[model samples]
Target: MSKIEEVKAKVEIGKTKLVPALVQEALDEGSTPAMILQAMVDSMGVVGDKFSKGEIFVPEMLIAAKAMAKGVDVLRPLLAGDSETSLGTCIIGTVAGDLHDIGKNLVAMMIESAGFTMVDLGVDVPAEKFVEAIKENERVTLVACSGLLTTTMPALKEAVQTIKAAYPDQKVIVGGAPVTPEYAAEIGADGFAPDAGSAAVKAKEIISV
Candidate 1:
């Protein structure tokens, strides 16, 4: 098979150690840096879909993301001049009264892979902090809020509402264990994703519109 396809396959299986070398090999074989990068990104998209479908769990998904990260590291130098996927800065954080981070971290990585510059606010983030991040960051095209609990769901709503109150047109996407599309709509979020994989897709969709 071609080096680019090999890179994609290795990344999907989470071959963290092998993906870098394969990416380099693909570069050696005359594959353009952009094409190789897209291969890895597409691999993550496949991995994400599997995660959303329950075919794989967190460890598997994280492994694939790490593999893609390794490949990206190999291509980062060559890609310095290629600003094609820059969707602008995205602010992400878990809502207040909740400390869960695995989901948020996963979403952050996937969203970054999809080309947005991520500013992660980490866990237990208060509502105003989301707005504060938007105000502080440049070209903030999207804000992503995560909540992993039923109780902290209100914090998610509060966070989205606060950001909307401050910046009515700010695009917000919400997700986590307890978040639903209906709830996201009620909370004034621009979008809702069911899992980390779809979060990247949702982030891109929110930014594009």
Candidate 2:
């Protein structure tokens, strides 16, 4: 198999050593940092699909993310340390009144692993914060809302409406335990994600389409 394909397979199998070793190989072969980054990102995309389908669980996802991060760390400086220019920017957070952040954090990592620059606002993010981030960061095209609880889920709707009202072209994507695609549509969100891996895919879809 080709080197990139080998790296992708290793990532799918959740091998922690795969990325770092393949990164070294890529560097030795005089592959550009950009090429290596794209390979790693593609691997993460594969991992995301497997995760969404339940072929891989959270622990495996974390392991693959860690590997991807290691590869990125090695290539960061060589790429001029510009994560945003290389990977499109994205804003993500747990919606207001929701203190739980495990799911949000996972989604952030998965997105980052897929080579999207992430602005993680953490938990309890108000609707205004989402709008402010979108306005300030024009590079940020995708906004992800996560709420683990039913009570705090309304924040997703509020944030989506507030952002869309301010920028009619904006796209808001909602996820978390209590969120559904129908509910996302009802709230005027652009998309819904069933899991963190799917969230990464959904973010890419919104940005590309």
Candidate 3:
């Protein structure tokens, strides 16, 4: 099989020790960094789908994400471009009372790879902190709020409303296990992404509008 395919397979199985080198080898074998990165991201999608199907649990998903992260570290420099021409800053965090960050971190990585400077507020972040981040950062174009629990969904709404109220035109995107597109619209988010890859695409789409 091709080196890129090997990279994807290793990432899917959560081979943390092998993915980085395989990613670098794929890069050396005339595979562009973006192509290798996409392979790893696709692996994560497969992992997520497996998780959704109950074929894998949180530990499995976390390890797969870790493996993908390792592969990404190998491609980060090649994936990132000039910051001055960036799409703009994206403020991302898991909403208040939610400590889940694997999904948040994955979205941050993908969005950063898509060329936005990311200001990650970390987990259990209050809604006011998002506004504070936007106000403090220049060219802030997107705010992404994540909530993995049904219980924290309200925190997600509070975050979107707070940011929108503070800056009427501010673009907000919301997601996590329980967040649906309809609920996102109901809660005032400009966009909703079901996964990290789509989050990057949606972030770019939001900023271009």
The candidate that wins on lDDT is 1
lDDT of 3 by residue, 1-209 (tens): 99999999998888999999998889889998867876775676677667656788767766777887788778778767644436789999999999999999978866765557789999999999999999899989999999999999999999999999999999999999999999999999999998776777788788873
| lDDT, candidate 1, at 121 | 97
User: What C-alpha lDDT, on a 0 to 100 scale, does residue 195 get in candidate 1?
Assistant: 84
What CA RMSD would you report for each candidate?
A: 1.7, 2.0, 4.2
Worst 10 residues of 2 by lDDT: 80-89
Tens digits of per-residue lDDT, candidate 2, 92-178, equal 988889899999999999878766778999999999998899878857778888888999767888988988988788877888888
**Predictions in order: lDDT:** 0.90, 0.82, 0.85
Candidate 3 wrong stretches, greater than 4 Å? 82-90, 96-118, 137-142, 147-155, 175-183, 191-209
TM-score of each: 0.92, 0.90, 0.70
The residue-level lDDT of candidate 3 at 194 comes to 89
Give lDDT: candidate 3, residue 42: 65
Task: Find the candidate with the highest TM-score and give its number.
Answer: 1
What order do you get sorting by TM-score, best first? 1, 2, 3
